[model samples]
Target: MSGSAVRSLVSALLLMVLLAAAGCAGGKKEPETLTVFAAASLTESFGTLGKAFEKSHPGVTVKFNFGGSSTLAQQIVQGAPADVFAAASPATMKQSGAPSPRIFARNRLEIAVPKGNPAHVAALKDLANPAVKVALCAEQVPCGAAAVKALAAGGVTVKPVTQEQDVKAALSKVRLGEVDAALVYRTDVKAAAGAVEGIEFPEADKAINDYPIAAVPKTAHLVLAREFIDLVLSDQGRRVLTDAGFTAV
Candidate 1:
């Protein structure tokens, strides 16, 4: 009835309307997340790629599950929720049941030693020396399979002090001085950088592993999954992978 009363009522209604609009906007702002399952050897490169993808695609978040290729592949096969699968080996990819996989990169095994090469491991054969404690990836992992092939090519047989589940774990043994040396991917040794030194062996060429990537058929976000895979196969992704020591496929 009064002018001041009417003005107060109008202000209350306007505040309620603004609050309602804010609620609606908040409800509509849901982030898009893309889940990627990748090999442990790809940790560094894929981490960089994921961040880059997030920056380039606003409102999209990239999440990665990095582990041994065999382990990751098995996880995918067991109905794990993943939008994409990036494996370190075709064998693992095939086991994962991810269709239409494309080889994105290649990697070879290298002997990784402590930063100072305390054990003075000079070659692959040296790993066979009973005095040198060595670590290797388990037979199930891609790196382990490569290591076995490389050792056979070099006519060397090593009894590793420990067999790790992944290349990174094997490398970690060298870094922590738990083992005098370990066989891991060149990319992994590069990722370890100053923490470990990579020793290139002639036999490594015989056991190069191909890294493949594919989108999961049951991906909830098909478009985003495809886009992420495309980005990984792009020039920028190649640059990142190369920087991390992966050879382009």
Candidate 2:
């Protein structure tokens, strides 16, 4: 072949090779991300479940947005992109308008005190004492509502030094020694066992919160959402939650 003809042929072959490389690259799909909006209390257990799910599901990533159930519900209602929601209460789950939410676990409140129980907060009523500085979740959140119910059941009215937006924030007060005591979920206390002590009160039973999980109505990845929920409700999910101090339903 002439020099110009040979050059033209080489250019054509190079173009074909580039096109073939592009086709192969396109054939390998990018990983899909499954976003979950879950209650702050579910952080530990869900973290474990997310890793397990990613291992079982290749080319898929589990992303979590953990916060107060009420806040998470409002976000979903406001059109935040989410695949699934795990709420700390059915009431919060309903607010999200996620169809067919199912209860997966239950949690109860406990008095979280500093490592040594510096305030000597023994029972629910102790929180009412003026000498005790307490932190509590706001009433709009599940933990806060449960705290209100538990306090009412014990006929104890407390004025917390601060009202946190989520259970983790409230628990952080105790962990940081910023507050003498805080009313938080049993699971949170368990997760922070080294930083605080859980004082179980009889009144907590009256305010046990039922956790619910469901795929969001507008989920983009419907199949992945359902699969993640399945994993959360599976036997392994139960063991993870139970180990984290949540009562399996």
lDDT of each: 0.91, 0.95
Best by TM-score: 2
* Tens digits of per-residue lDDT for model 2, 1-249: 899999999999999999999999988668899999999999999999999999999899999999999999999999999999999999999999999999999999999999999889899988999999999999999999999999999999999999998999999999999999999999999998578999999999899999999999979999999999999999999999999999997
Candidates' TM-scores?
Answer: 0.88, 0.90
Q: List candidate 1 segments past 4 Å from native.
A: 1-29
Task: Say which candidate scores most in lDDT.
Answer: 2
Runs of candidate 2 with Cα error greater than 4 angstroms are: 1-27
* Model 1 agreement with the true structure over 15-133: per-residue lDDT tens digits: 99999999998775478899999999989999999999899888889989999989988888899999999998999999999899999999988899998898999999999999999
Clashing pairs in 2: none
In model 1, the Cα lDDT at residue 24 comes to 94
- Clash counts for the predictions, in order: 0, 0
